[model samples]
Target chain A: MSRTRVQHFSISLDGFGTGEGLSRQAPFGHAGERLHAWMFATRFGKTMFGQQGGTSGVDDAILSTFAVGIGAEIMGSNKFGYPGWHENKDWTGWWGANPPFHTPVFVMTQHKRAPLELEGGTVFHFTDAPPADVLAMAREAAGGRDVRIGGGVRILRAFLKERLIDHMHLVQVPILLGRGVRLWDGLEGLEQVFDIETTASSSGVTHLMFARKGG
Target chain B: MSRTRVQHFSISLDGFGTGEGLSRQAPFGHAGERLHAWMFATRFGKTMFGQQGGTSGVDDAILSTFAVGIGAEIMGSNKFGYPGWHENKDWTGWWGANPPFHTPVFVMTQHKRAPLELEGGTVFHFTDAPPADVLAMAREAAGGRDVRIGGGVRILRAFLKERLIDHMHLVQVPILLGRGVRLWDGLEGLEQVFDIETTASSSGVTHLMFARKGG
Candidate 1:
C-alpha cells in the first residue's frame, strides 16, 4: 500500500518549522541554519549535497530514510521558493539545475503555471486544489511507491489536521526560535490519532516518529 | 551565591509545560500523568513518594536534583493550587499535610493572603510582587542556599524571559499537548543566553539542561 510520509522535517524546540521573515536571501530568516544544522552534519546530508566527510551516526541513519521509497512529493509553495516566486516567472527553485526530488513534485499554489521539467527527472506541477485532491493526484503519480509531504510548517499542519499523514518523522532541534510560524498551533491532542515515539541523538536533535493508529 | 534553578520540569514535545483546563481534580488537565510518567518510573520519584523499587538511570539521576541544596521555592499560584484557590480559604494545597517542598515557598498570586504553614517544612507565602522582588524575598528566606523556581508554565516563562534562571532542567516527554499555555512563547533567541545540552533517556524522555552562560 502506498503511504503518505513526512521524513526528516526539522522543527525548533518551540515547534517553529521555519522562522519569520523568510526571504530569498534568508530562507529561514532569524533561525538561519540552526534548526537544520544537525541534518547538514549527517552523512546523508553530505552525500545529498555532493559533499564529502560527515558523521555517520544515529542522525545520519534517520536522515538516510528520506528518499528511500519516495516516488512523488507534495511541497508547499514556500518550500519551492521565496514568498514572491510567482512574481518572477523565470524562477525555478533554490535547487540549481538538478533538484533533489527525482519524481513529479506537486507545488500547492494559488497561481497555477505551466508544468516545468528540470534536469534529472525532476518535474514541477502547480495546482491550487485542496489537500485531498492534490494528494490523490500525487499518489497516482507515486506509481506504487510512497508519497512524501514536503513541508514549510503550514502545509504540514494542514495535512496533519485532516489526518492525511500515515507516517511522520520529525526532528526536534534544541535551539529555541521564539518567534515563527508554529507547527503545533491547532494540533491539540495529536496523541489520540498517532502513536508517537522519540529518540534523542548525540547531535542534540531528538527524533520523533508518529505513525497513524489503525490507519 | 544563591542560584535560581529549575529541575524535573516536564513538557510535551510541543513545548507545553502544562495542558489546558487545569483544576483541582485534573492538575495537568488533558495531559494527565503522561508528562510526568517518565519521572514517576524513576527511583528518585519512588523514594520521594514513599514507595519502593524504581529504575535508577539518567532520569532518576536528573530527578534526584529536585530537592538537593534548594532552600526556598518560588512557584506560580497555579502550581500551588487550582485556579481561584483564594475563594476557598481552607484549601492548603494538593500535596496534603506533608508536601515535597521542605522550605519557604512563595506563591505568586493577585489575591494575596496570610501565609499557610503545612505539616512539613513547607510554608506557603502569598505574594503579588514581580519576579525580581519575589526572588529577593525567597533568597532571604533561603538563608545562603540556592532558590528553586517551581513552575506551572506561566511563572517559569516569566522568569526565563527576565533571564533570572541560572540553571534549568526540562524533560521533553514524547506526548504532544496541542493546546496549552506554551513555555517558549516570547522567549525568542533564548539560545544566546544559556548553553543548552540534551540527553535522551531509555524511558523515552529527553532531558534538556540549560545553564546560564558565565553563571
Candidate 2:
C-alpha cells in the first residue's frame, strides 16, 4: 500500500510552519530560515545544498528518509515558488536546474503551465485539482511507490484537515515565531486519529511522528 | 538570588495551556487531564496525589522539581478552582485540606478573600494586585527563596509578558486541545530574551526549559 506521507516538515514552537509576509526575497518571511536551521545542520541537508560535513545524528537520519519509497510529490504553489511566481514564466523553481525531488512533482496551482522536465528526473506538473484527485493522480504517477505531501503550511493543513495524510514527521523547533501560517489551527483532537511519538535531537529540536490510526 | 520560575507547566502541541469551556466539573475543560497525563504517569505526580509506583525517568525528574527552592507561588484564580469558584465561599482549593504547596500560595483574583492556611504549610492568599505588585509581595513572602509562578495560562502569560519570569519549564504534550486559552499568544521572539533547551522524555512528552538571559 502506498502511504501519503509528509516528511521533514518543520514548525515553530508556536505552531507556525512559515512566518508572516512570505515573499520571493524572504521565502519564509520574518521566520527566515530559522525553521529549517536544524535540517541544514544535518548531513542530509548539507548534502542537499551541495556542501559537506554535518551532524550524523537522529536529525540527519530522519532527514535522510526524504527519498525512501517516494515516487511522487504533491506540493502547493506557494511551496513550489514564491508568491506571484506564476507571473514569472521563466521561473523553474528555487532549485537551479536539477531539483532535489527526483520524482513526479505535482505543483497545485490555479495558473496552469506546461510540464517542465528538469534535470535528475524531477518533472514539475502544474495542476489545479483538489487534494483527493491530486493524490489519486500522484499515486497513479507514483507507480507503486508512496506519495509525498510537500507543504507550505496551507497545503499540509488542507491534507491534514481532510485526513488524507497517512504518516507525518514534524520537526518542532523551539523558537517561537509569533505569527505565520499555523499548522494546527483547525486540527483539534488530533491525538484521537493518530498515534504520535516524540524524539529530541542533540541540537535541541523535537521530532514528532504522527501515524494515522489503523491506516 | 531569588528567581521567578514556572515548573511542571503543561501545554498542548497547539500551545493551549488549558482547554476551553472551563467549569467546576471539568477543571481543564475538554482537555481534561490529557495535558498532564505525562506528569501523572511520573512518580512525582503519583506521590502528589498520595499514590505510589510510577516512572522515575526524565519526566518524573522534571516534575519532582515542582518545589525545588520555591517558597511562594502566584497563580490565577482559574487554577485555584474552576470558573466562578469565588461564588462558592467555602471552597479552599481542589487539593483537599492538605494541598501540595508547603509555602505561601497567592491566588490572583479580583475578589478579596482571607488567607486560608491549610495543612502542610500551604496558605492561599487572594490578591487583586497587578503582576509586579503581586510578584513583590510573593518575593517578600518567599523569604529569599525562589518564587514560583504557578500558572493557569493567564497568570504565566502575564508574568512572561512583564519579563518577570526568570526560568520556566514547559512540558509540550502531543495532544491537541483545539480550543482553549493559548499560552504563546503575543509572546513573539521570546528566544531573544531566553535560552531554551529541549529534551524528549520516555513518556513521549518534550520538556522545554527557558532560562531568562542575564537572570
lDDT of 1 by residue, B131-167 (tens): 9999999999999999999997999999998999999
Candidate 1: list runs displaced more than 4 Å. none
TM-score of each: 0.94, 0.97
Worst 10 residues of 2 chain B by lDDT: B197-206
Clashing pairs in 2: none
Per-residue error for A2 in candidate 2, Å, reads 1.3
Off by over 4 Å in 2: none
Give lDDT: candidate 1, residue B70: 97
Could you give candidate 2's per-residue lDDT for residues A1-215 as a string of tens digits? 99999998999999999999989999999999999999899899999988999999999998999999999999999898999999999999998889999999999999999999999999999999999999999999999999999998999989999999999999998898999899998999889899999888879888899999998
Best by TM-score: 2
Extract clashing residue pairs from model 1: A188-B178
What local lDDT does model 1 show for residue A154?
Answer: 92
Error of 1 at A147 (Å): 0.9
